[model samples]
Target: MTDLSLIRNFSIIAHIDHGKSTLADRLIQITGGLSERELKEQVLDNMDIERERGITIKAQTVRLDYTAKDGKTYELNLMDTPGHVDFAYEVSRSLAACEGALLVVDAAQGVEAQTLANVYQSIEHDHEIVPVINKIDLPAADPDKVKLEIEEVIGLDASEAVLTSAKSGIGIEDVLEAIVTKIPPPSGSRDKPLKAMLVDSWYDPYLGVVILVRVLDGALKKGDQIRFMQGGTQHLVDRVGCMRPKIEQLSEIGPGEIGFITAQIKEVEQARVGDTITTVKNGATEALPGYREPQPVVFCGLFPVDAADFEKLRESIGKLRLNDASFSYEMETSAALGFGFRCGFLGLLHLEIIQERLTREYDLDLITTAPSVVYRIQLGHTKTEDAQEILLHNPADYPDPSRIESIEEPWIKATIYTPDEYLGSILKLCQDRRGIQTDLTYVGGRAQVSYELPLNEVVFDFYDRLKSISRGYASFDYEQIGLREGDLVKMSILVNGDPVDALSMIVHRSVAEDRGRHMCERLKELIPRHLFKIPIQAAIGGKVIARETISALRKDVTAKCYGGDITRKKKLLEKQKKGKAKMREYGNVSIPQEAFIAALRMGEE
Candidate 1:
């Protein structure tokens, strides 16, 4: 068993594309965790989607044995965490399992918004953060400036910050040495009853459910009967192991160690993240302070294109949920989209990744509805003692405006960092979305601005627009603030006087008319011209705010009456008009799947 003082548990935290994974690869290489032939770029990113997207969606853990210059061999447990704001929950959980974090910053880019957000989280967890200025080999890299920025913005001491080029393996040893010496080792007693924290769990085809755990107060051994403190489900531990990028079986996982355990658990749901694990007999009486449940801020509907594939989609979603606990869904049938699940996500990126996984991993074609944020609807006046408040998930389920005393929409405090050249456009974009400027500061030629914006506005195309306007230089990170009263209304799209529940959305009143007009125009272009004219209208309550008409594909009933008298031709046309009107009343506007997809992808044009 490794001594507690000789073991260090730490995580690598940084902004997206700031070299967290690359640094991990270097560390693994120098420490001999993997042979040169076995080592690949981003070896921890095992998922195909993660590799293809070049982003770490899941936090990966690996154990490495390193011999320090002082001639002492140490055990290092490294948690490589995602940098995207959508995966902040994953980062937090990983941080909870570590005693320190490597705060990576792009040497050229200084510090971005997500860097600040993650640093604050690490500080909140009481992690001893070691600053690392990465990408020093780049021509634009300014390590001195980045160090100063880190000290000023994050208030972390950067005097001893290590400068390294993770891509070229520069300063890899220094980083490792800093981890061994600067980061404190976890404190726990092995004599106590087994008390492990379930850091994460995923389904393995052969192993069933493989749980990654951090032993807090005891040792977990193979064949031991373990009970989940939160779930109260007991299982016999079949295997105890640690990942050296690949699983290596262990006889026992001692206190202050991070490892994996398989207890013959059939489902990943049974092994909840942040649950306390202990021996079934003589288990600890009190459970560890587990993590807070990740709250999904954005929601949308995912329906299969083929109605028959609903069951397949359901199964695929269930399987995906086994790995991602933050994703949530419920069965809901729509008037236009048929049966589907209304799913909640942490953000748009989270929603996109999940949808992409459903399509790529599960081989399912899905149509996603416009993303929306949760809203609080007060059923009666606030003065009433028993005023009912309903949480609105779907716009189609919006309460009657008369009955709603006030509609409060979720708001977010957004931090944006961008070069000075793109500041104007970024500010204009925020203003267009009804965002209130909270603060503005300048850091070494870059503008760091804070805004309070409605989450609904950010849910749809805000990130895309921000990226485009700033030429991908701007980075954004946001946290949900409490809901505030807003003039919000449900905007519904009507095709031939029938409302399409899939296209309905809860929008703020100020821009509803323009938004409705935009939707109507887009739908008019996307929906094919039928035998009868189809009037696409956007309405709020009973009031039609915008309308577009798709003219009928006429057959020219009077084409053969060229030589006939005017009355004959007129009579033929009149007969055709009556038939068209009858068809309009009876014909079902079969909206093609492409139309729904294009209509939901609004603001791109």
Candidate 2:
């Protein structure tokens, strides 16, 4: 029998596109957790989008049984976490399942904003850090520089750095050996009361809600009745299982084991991702470890194009909510967009994914308004509530000055890491976006700057501008800081001539003039002229500053179709006329694609 004390539970953490997934594939191969016949890079991130995007969106866990040359079989539970800041909450939950973290840094690129943030998170969790300098086979690989930077910036030992090319499988075996040698084993008594905290979860069609958890104390088994600390729900455990990355059914789960438990649960709301699952009758005297409250940083209006599809969209969102507990939904409507729901999310990416899934998976066409960060306002003699409570999604519902005391909006603790050459450009870009630089430090040849920015400033194109300014060499990451007082106004766009009420945003009044003017110009490029000229305007409270005129269709229908069929030409012109009517006609203009695309791109800028 292998010595169980040698078993190590750990996770790989890094910035997006920094080879975290690639390194994970190599580790799987070396430990024989995956066979040669089943080899595929980044297989742990099985979702189609994950592979296409080359990023891991969710955390996956696997166990590897490796026998060292000393003839010892050690079981290693390896958790692969998402590298993007969008999934920071999920990342934290994944970290709770492991006792150590392998902090992988790009040898050439050095540390990124996400890397620094994740490293800080790991330290907060009190996990032992094992630094791995990855992508060493690249032409720009600089292990010595990265090693020294890690020691100086993060206070880790330079000698402990493991230089590896996970792509070429170099230094992978040593990494495993280092895990056994450096990372400590889980410590807890199996005899304690059964207390385990659930991290990430999924609803399998066959197994119902498969809850992934780390046993903080004692043991749990099949046939046990579990009580969920969340909402005080309870269920009978039908099965307990562990993942070899290929599910292995087990009779029980022991202390420090990351595994799943299945009950007869039909709905996922009962077994939330961060909920505590415990023995009903013989569970812990206190609640399970690592429970966190869900908070939403961004909110958007989602409405189906067809009223008949409303219920379908609602059902689709319900299904998505099963997998993502952080996403919340509330019934909301707007005169411009009609029936819709106000969906809450952790960040911009979360809102986009839900919209994409609603269209792709649910097969429902949607009309989503621009995302808005929830604002806080003091009303009615010092009563504080989210500005969203004022129902500002509709212009008619916006509160008057007398009804509001002070308006507060979300803020972000943002960090941007880039090459030293791009510092000036990046600073100018950040300044334009209203970002306040709180600190700046040098890591190797790269520079890291911390900014306290209003989330509204970045909710649009901060990421895009960061990449554009740095020539795609810079990376940025942010986490929600609290809410702050802000001077913002709801600006509306008059598509063609008529104002479509749904397409408005809460923007800083200072930039409204420039943004409106730029938006109208961009819209002129997207919207095609039909029968009449189209005038696109950006206005705040009925005041228009910038305007664009889309000239009328000069030659929409030729005086003759040449030698072509006249019926086809007539039908096309008739269709064009019908499109003009369907458009929200304001005065004499007809708006088209350019207007919609411009509105969409505004969020990016």
Q: Clashing residue pairs, candidate 1?
A: none
Collision count for each candidate, in order: 0, 8
Per residue, candidate 2 scores C-alpha lDDT tens digits across 1-605 of 12348668899989888899998899888878778998887879887678878888778989888887678888898999888887887888888778899999999888778888889889888998999999999999889988888888888886878889999999998888888878888877777778788877777878877888888777778888888877588888888888877899987888877788888877666666667777888777677556677777777778887778888888888888877777889888765556878888888777777788788877987876666777766655435643333424333345665667667787888888889999999888888888888999887778888989988878777777778778899888888888788887767778665776666667888888888887788777776666566677888776887898877655556555677787888887897777666653543443332354356656565
lDDT of 2: 0.79
TM-score for each candidate, following the candidate numbering: 0.96, 0.88
lDDT on C-alpha atoms for all candidate structures = 0.91, 0.79
C-alpha lDDT of residue 520 in model 2: 80
For candidate 2, the 10 contiguous residues with the lowest summed lDDT are 387-396
- Best by the lDDT measure: 1
RMSD of each: 2.1, 6.2
Candidate 1: residue 275 lDDT (0-100): 86
